[model samples]
Target: MPKLWNETIDAHREQVREAIVNVTSTLVFEQGLRAVTMSQIAEHAGIGRATLYKYFPDVETILRTWHARQIDSHISELTQVRAGAGSPGERLDAVLASYAHIAHQTGSHDRELVKFLHPDERIVNAQNQLREIVRQLIEEGATAGELRDDVDPAELANYCLHALSGAAELTTAEAIARLVALTAAGLRPPQS
Candidate 1:
C-alpha cells in the first residue's frame, strides 16, 4: 500500500477504536458492567460484531482500554493544573484541590468498576505519577518555607494523596473543599 493509503487506514482504525471505547463506556454507565455485552457495543458503535471482536476480544479488554485512556487524560489534566500560574504554595494548593475534585467525581462511579480497574499495573503506575506530582509540589513549598520542614516530602505526598481520597465519599463541593483545606493545612509550618 502507498504511504497515504496506510496512514488513512491507520486513522480509520483509530476512529473505529475510539468509537468502540466511547460507546462501550456509555453502555457500561447506563447498564452496569455486567449488563453490557459485545453485541450491544457493536450496535451502539455502528460496527459489526466481527469488527468489534477484531478490536477487542472481550468486554473486560474494552473497559480496561477505556480506563487506560481515562488515566492518561487525568494525568495530563493534573500536570496542567500543576503548571498553572501560582507560587509554589499556590500551585500545590491548586494541584491538591484539582485531585480532590477528580477523586470526588470518579468516586461516584460503580464500586465494582473501581475494584476491577484499580488493580492493573497501569493504575499502579498512574498512582505513582500522581504521588510524584504531589511530592514535587510539597518539596517546592518546603524549600520556600511555605510548607512544613518537619516531615519528609515523600511522607507528606503520601499523606496528601490518602487524605484527599476521602473526597470521594463526600457528597458536596463544600464538603470536598473543606477536606482539601484540612489536608492542605497539615502541610503548613507550625506557628511559633
Candidate 2:
C-alpha cells in the first residue's frame, strides 16, 4: 500500500487504541484495577464485549500491554536522545529534558496513569529497565569524562529514575527543572 494509505490505517488504529486507553484508564482510576471488568470497558467504549476481548482478553493483559507500550515509547525517545551526539553533561541534560517532557505528556488529569504505574511490581520492572538505561548512559558519559568517575553509575541511575516517578503528580515544568538540578548534581565530575 501507499504511504498515505498506511498512514490512514495507522491513524485509525491510534484512534481506536486511544478510545480503549481512555475508557480503561478512567475505569481503573475511578474503580480500581480489580473492579474494572472487561465488560465494563466494552460498555464504556461502546464496543461489544467480544470486541473488547478481541483487543484484550483480560484486564491484566490490558495493563501489561499499556505498560509495555509506554516503556517502548520512552525507550525509543531515549534512543533519539542518544543520537544527538554531545558531551556527557549535555547528553544527560538532554535526556533528562526529554524524559521530563514525556512525563508531562503522560500525566493525565484523571489520575489513571499514576494508578496504573504507582509503586508496584509492574512499575518496579519499568523503573528497573529505565535505571539500567540510565546507568548505561552514565557509563558512556563517564567513559567520555562527562560525569563523575567515583559515583556508581547504577546507583545514581537508580536514584534519578526512581526520583522521576513523582512526575506523575507534578504539574509544572519547574518540577522537571528541579529533577534536572538533582540529576546534574549527582552526575557532576568530582573535583580532584
Candidate 3:
C-alpha cells in the first residue's frame, strides 16, 4: 500500500480501537463488570462482533485495556505535575493534591469493578510509579530542608500515599484539600 494509504488505515484502526475501549467502559459502568458482554460492546460501539473479536478476545481483556489506558493517563498527569516549575515543597504539594483529586473522582466506581481491577499487574506497576514519583520529591524536599529527614524517604512516600487515600471517601473538595494538607503536614520535621 502507498504511505498515505497506510497512514489512513492506521488512523482508522486507532479510531476504531478507541471507540471499542470507550464503549466497553461505558457499558461496564452502566451494566456492571460481569453483566457487560463483548456483543453488547460491539453493538453499542457500532462495530460488528467479528471486528470486536478481532480487536479483543474477551470482555475482561477490553476492561483491562481500558484500565491500563486510564493508568497511563494518570501517571502522565502526575509526571507533569512533578515536572512543573516550582520549589520542591510546592511541587510535592501540587502532586499530592492532584493525586487526591484523582482518588476523589474515581472513588464513586462500583466496589465490584474496583475489586476486579485492583489485582492486575498494571495496578502494581502504577502504584510503584506513584511511589517513586513521591519518593523522589520527598528526597528533594529533605535536601531543601522542606521535609523531615529522620525517616527514610521511601517510608515517608508510603505514608503520604496511605494517608492521602482517605480522599476517596471524602464528599467535598474541601475535605480532599484538608486530607492533602494533613498528609503533607505529616512529612514535616518536628518544631524545636
| 29-92 per-residue lDDT for model 3 (tens digits) | 8989889888798899999999999999998888889999999999999999999998888899
Best by lDDT: 1
Question: For model 1, how does the per-residue alpha-carbon lDDT over 35-102 read when each residue is reduced to its tens digit?
Answer: 99999999999989999999999999999999999999999999999998988889999999999999
lDDT of each: 0.94, 0.74, 0.92
Task: Give the winner by lDDT: 1 or 3.
Answer: 1
Per-residue lDDT for 20 in model 3?
97
- Runs of candidate 2 with Cα error greater than 4 angstroms are 1-22, 26-37, 101-125
- What TM-score goes with each of the models? 0.97, 0.69, 0.97
- Which segments of candidate 3 are over 4 A away from where they belong? none
Prediction RMSDs, each to the true structure: 0.9, 4.7, 0.9
- TM-score between candidate 1 and the true structure: 0.97
Worst 10 residues of 3 by lDDT: 102-111
- In terms of TM-score, how similar is model 2 to the real structure? 0.69
